[model samples]
Target: LEWAGDEFPWVLEHHSNLEPETQTWHSKLVTENWDSPIIFTSMVQFLEVLFGGGSRGARRMHNIANSVLIFDEIQSLPVNCVHLFCNAIQFFVDHARSTTLLCTATQPLLDNLKFPDKGQLTLPDDRELVGNMTEVFEQFKRVEIKNLVRPKGWSEQKLIELMITQLKEKGNCLVIVNTKKWAKKLYDRCINSVDADSLFHLSTSLCPVHRKEVFNTVRQRLDDELPVLCISTQLIEAGVDVDFNSVIRFLAGLDSIAQAAGRCNRNGNLDMAQVYVVNPQDEAIDMLPDIKEGREKALRIFSEKDETELLDPEVMSLYFSYYFYERANLMSYPLTEKQAGRKDSLLSLLSDNHLNIGIEKNAIKLQQSFKTAGKAFKAIDSPTQAVIVPYGDKGKEIIAGLCADFEPAKAFKLLKEAQKYSVNVFPNVWRKLIDAEAVKPVQKGEGIYFLEERFYSENFGLSTEVVSKMDTKIS
Candidate 1:
């Protein structure tokens, strides 16, 4: 506050492929230098800066010192990077003189973070800002979660009936499923049954701008006490402001369940809200190992604890303890593909370079592979590609601009705007689109791909099914 003399957050940052203007702005305000009092960044950017490389950390070292680092929804941090992340934070506090604040309703067992050399990270005993967290969580409770996981899961028809009933009773309802395919299926099944105006869908398949439009419509419907139903993936689980009187969440970790509940009674307009955890028949989560493992862990807690104690801060701590303990072997990002079965991780490469057992190096610094470590680690740890979709007028306009004669300044600005209209797809889905000639590069070898307008849907989003020239295919 004292340094910038600005009351608002001017440095909104996510360090990745950026426009030239924004890049200049980042340096102009020393945002990369971490001089701003308040700046919002993605987990990817944060992890990249922390573990990406030595040069990045070195550049921001003095600036980040004494700054308060707040990690919202800390539970969403990747399990593979837990120990590495914990050690990095421990180093920041002990040696770099920075304060780290982990904020989440579902508090993880990060306090028990263990390092190999250092037995345990000694977190601060007291947080002056947040005293008596248990009472705080209890006092702030707004939703009551009910478990409805049955031996035979709810059928598609039964799930729709429940959603309709909830919408009629609660005025607005939100159903969050495990995957996009399921979300699309639910949206399609209810399209003819429910009024078009009252039904909505939200997922990463829709561009950010399209999703924002849906968010606005959903928020307005909730505010007006209208009977609205939304089918969505886990995209609305956190960082979304819309509130629903009732919500249906597919079973997952307690942390994820808590995040799902956050979307209900967000501002506490209702006296109390209901969150139903359901298991759907034929629900596919095999590809989503995180959600699959999380559901298994949550089931264990359900057997051991009462429903009322499920959302308790202590219970959350317990869930994370079980979660971390089970995945202790994977806390370090293991080098899998080429170096599998060697017990090598990015942490080892960054730390002691146990790979170099008896070798001695001079001033060349071959002991650590900072570049290799950065290259090996991905924040989400998924191989995904971005495709610019033509969702609406803005999306079309941006695409047109990018397709025009590639003027340097104009193209840079248009490329920045493309981010709002882009959708990320997995490699297989991308290949499907490419094979169908549904997407083409914005430039020859720039790696930026644009989706055909025919492939994008007004009701859902990107369709990955095989398509004939005359028809659109969605599966």
Candidate 2:
């Protein structure tokens, strides 16, 4: 909205349809005409329509039949959905005649995916969209990665000092950490050391509105050539377009490192930018299995090759190939159950007519378990529930509107606006808040929750500190 201005006919279609314009555009996109030339939607929405059991989903399938489908950040696709997703893509290309593009800095080996009875999902003519991809990688190389990980990781104080030093040496700096807890802690320490305006923080905990405001301020400062420091989680690693003179990243996947590098000297304006990879002492590697595995594989690659090889296309291909090989079983939706010991996957349920047939006294009848399979397909492993936090005046207004008796449409509008003030919390933390009466259900059995003012902080949207302290007091 900031780049193209509000007048531009565009829509952001995610869970948060906060704007009426966006809501209108989304409604239009799912309709028969699908009049919107440009439409943005989540992967869940895309998959749901393909495998979802409903008349609405059927209608959406028809609407998307011949549309040009583009999947960005293709690496982020869940491993469990790889087979199901690949099968859907093949269906789109062969049956629907749709043009599909999977764009990512670190492209997975989709051709290696094996489908039941369908064989490997192969691209037509096995052609490359961009010939000589190595040349493209070399041309885009603007930053040099410096490995700072050691046996003993750097302390929080040491990390903060290093960041301050970088800010002084470099005009602007960005620090990407592994977790929100670390990001907030580093931000607090950095805020004390630097000017309030120069220091910034970004995390999933903050509402979309708050994050947008922070991004706008950071951009303005960067444009003006002022001192700016942003401490963020992996949220800023992809899709976000911002350039910093120097970047400090915690040890993660090589693809994640590449994405982080893309943020530094992004436009090739700088002569050479620096990207530092450090291992933080405070973070627990065991808590994050994916990062641990990626780090292990990345470290092995680094041992074999030079640091500059990090940006090489062949090296990236090797990293992805190794990464996928480690979790090969996950490529197939293994968690999905079978019917009467009959091997069945979401792909089979959606695509195979024989699997959908059941014999009743020698009579074949259609019996596809679309709803059951759809319910099991989760893009993210640990699903989060959204809770509206009392952040500012707009948040208060949304809460007041929700409490009052309004029409269903008006209530939905309020809910959308509330999305900007919402924080996604795990079920355990949500239960703790509920027990403490710090939050209330927006509606019974609706899954929507609301946080009271006391539990919220202006600095941090939803304050876990308040919840913890309250729990202590109660105990």
Which candidate gets the maximum lDDT versus the true structure? 1
Residue clash pairs of candidate 1: none
lDDT over C-alpha atoms for residue 124 of model 1? 68
User: Residues 27-124, candidate 2, lDDT per residue (tens digit)?
Assistant: 33323223345556667557656654444456556756787998888877776677777777887889998888988888877787433444345676
TM-scores for candidates 1 onward, in order: 0.85, 0.82
What local lDDT score does residue 363 receive in model 1, on the 0 to 100 scale? 56
lDDT for 206 in candidate 2 is 75
After superposition, which runs of candidate 1 have C-alpha atoms over 4 Å from their true positions?
A: 1-9, 12-39, 49-68, 92-99, 114-122, 357-366, 465-475
For residue 401, give model 1's deviation from the true position in Å: 2.4
Error of 1 at 435 (Å): 1.0
Off by over 4 Å in 2: 1-12, 16-38, 44-63, 114-121, 125-129, 336-368, 467-475
